[model samples]
Structure formats: C-alpha cells, structure tokens
Target: MPAPHGFEHLVRGDEIVILHHGVRAATLRGAKAADFLARIDTEDPQLLMARLTGNYRRGNERAARRHPRNQS
Candidate 1:
C-alpha cells in the first residue's frame, strides 16, 4: 500500500497535537509528547500518527477477516 499521508503534528509548549486531514486527532502531553518527538523523524510519521491517534485499527478487523487469503 502507498505510504500514509495527511497527518501532521504541532508542538504547543510541552504538548504535541496530532492532526489528520487538517483536524485534531490527538493531543499528547508530558512523556508521550517527548516520546513522539523523539520518534517522529526516526520512524514512519504517518503510521505512527495514525497509531497514536487510534486511527490505525479503526474497525478494520471484519474486513481483514473477510479477505480471500483469510478464508478457511
């Protein structure tokens, strides 16, 4: 699959705000924000953002189970 996009982050003081498609997705504070910043450039930003914002696994289990390769 193509690399994920439309995810960005903003630092506000000690907090980090994650945005998806120009809207607020999640707000990380304290150690969470620190960890995110440390990995932001080292890891896949889009996937990390998605996972952090709880969008990575949003209701996709059923679809995955129904895939042809998953058939019994």
Candidate 2:
C-alpha cells in the first residue's frame, strides 16, 4: 500500500521510511511490504524539542506555577 496523506516516502540503505511533516514516522526493510506504521509519532517537532531542552517561554513559568500539579 501507499503511504498516508501528508507523508513523504524515502529509502535509506535497505530500509524504507516515511516522513510526516519533516519527522520520521516509520521504517521497513525491503520494498515489497505494505503500508508503513508510525513509530515515533509526534505533531510538532519544534515544540517537542523546546520542551526537552527546558526552553519554555518566560510567561510559561508563571502559568505552570498557577497550575495545581506544579504547586509541588
């Protein structure tokens, strides 16, 4: 089967992969397989990287403090 909408197909070595919005979705060996499955699925890579790097915006600290879960 073909890849899903908004996905681009690519081949690396002996593996076939799908990229969704510039992020890796899945990879399969060989080229005779069906549709690829999403592995490291994510919506926004930038936001994910920002969160990982502890780069939240200035006001976000206050907002987090206001939340009940962050009180501790």
TM-score of each: 0.75, 0.35
Taken over the whole model, the C-alpha lDDT of each candidate is 0.90, 0.49
Question: How many clashing residue pairs appear in each of the predictions shown?
Answer: 0, 0
Please state every model's RMSD to the true fold in angstroms.
4.4, 11.2
Candidate 2 lDDT score relative to the true structure:
0.49
- Per-residue CA lDDT of model 1 for 1-72, tens digit only, reads 456689999999889999999999999998899999999889999999998998785567889999999999
Number of the top candidate by TM-score?
1
Q: In candidate 2, what residue range of length 10 has the lowest lDDT sum?
A: 31-40
Summarize candidate 2's per-residue lDDT along 1-40 as a digit string, tens digits. 2223444556676666655567775566643322232322
Report lDDT (Cα) of residue 12, candidate 1: 90
Q: Which stretches of candidate 2 lie over 4 Å from their true place?
A: 1-4, 31-72
In model 2, how large is the Cα lDDT of residue 8?
58
Model 1 backbone overlap count: 0
